[model samples]
Target: MIIDCIDKYELYQGLGDGVSKALEFLVSHDLEALSIGKHEIDGQCVYALVSEYETKPADSSFFERHELYVDVQYVVRGEESIGYAPLQDQVVVKPYHEEHDYALHSGNASFVNLCGGMFAIFFPGDLHMPGISDVPGSVRKIVVKVKA
Candidate 1:
């Protein structure tokens, strides 16, 4: 997990070639106007965030592991807790769904608190539970989906 301002995204460029491009695209685009659609870049799949709704605890416990995409979740406003667990440590709670491109894993996942100006990257092997509320209020977040 990495938490930093959007302007500091350049420091994370070398983390991976595909991730770098995704970050660059996110930095250059107007997140507020982008539609929630899937777009391909450099043979990689990317999902833009157009808007956000209220997040709750029930929405937080659904951990998913994607086979073809890495989730680059950026927090534009508010704070939320994201549940996570290492891939190797997960016990399959349910079978993977090929159509949805993800699986459900079982375990006591850890939480990463994400506030505005922060972000987290979850690879294919990482199980993540997003949309968790920090307080009783709602949190608004922008999720940038990148091909794994």
Candidate 2:
């Protein structure tokens, strides 16, 4: 998984022309005003989702595998703790479901706190768990999905 600091996004422009454009759009836009839906910009698919307390905790099973479209998890407001574990480290607590494309694993996972402007990227094999609560309160975050 690539954990890019917002400032270093420019360096990755050559990686994928579309990804560069997607990152540019995310960096330039005001996340708070957006709705949860798909937005087409510069011929790229930008799926925007504004999440509040109503959103459920991310299913670890889902993130264990799958080539992700870049997962730009930005916290527009408040703090959130996200869980993570490497694929190689995973011990299957539950077998994968072909229909759902996920499986539950056994182990103590790691977590990271995402605040305003802070984000994380999860590629295939990088299992991530998001939407966790902080001690102070809940968080409002926006996840922009871009094809990787």
On lDDT, the candidate that comes out on top is: 1
TM-score per prediction, in order, is 0.80, 0.70
lDDT of 1 by residue, 1-148 (tens): 5656777889999878777877887687666565555555565466655446666774446678888877788876777778887788677877788777789886777887877777788878788888776455555566667766
lDDT of each: 0.73, 0.63
For residues 1-148, what per-residue lDDT tens digits would candidate 2 score against the true structure?
Answer: 5665666778767756666666787789877777765566644455666666633444432334444355667776777777777877667666767553446665556777777667676654567767765344657776666665
Worst 10 residues of 2 by lDDT: 54-63
Model 2 TM-score, all chains together: 0.70
Candidate 1, which ten residues in sequence have the lowest lDDT sum? 35-44
Output the number of the TM-score-best candidate. Answer: 1
Off by over 4 Å in 2: 42-45, 54-65, 89-106, 134-136
- In model 1, the Cα lDDT at residue 101 comes to 77
What lDDT, from 0 to 1, does candidate 1 have?
0.73
Instruction: Kindly give the number of clashing pairs for every candidate.
Output: 0, 0
TM-score, prediction 1: 0.80
> Cα lDDT for residue 33, model 2?
76
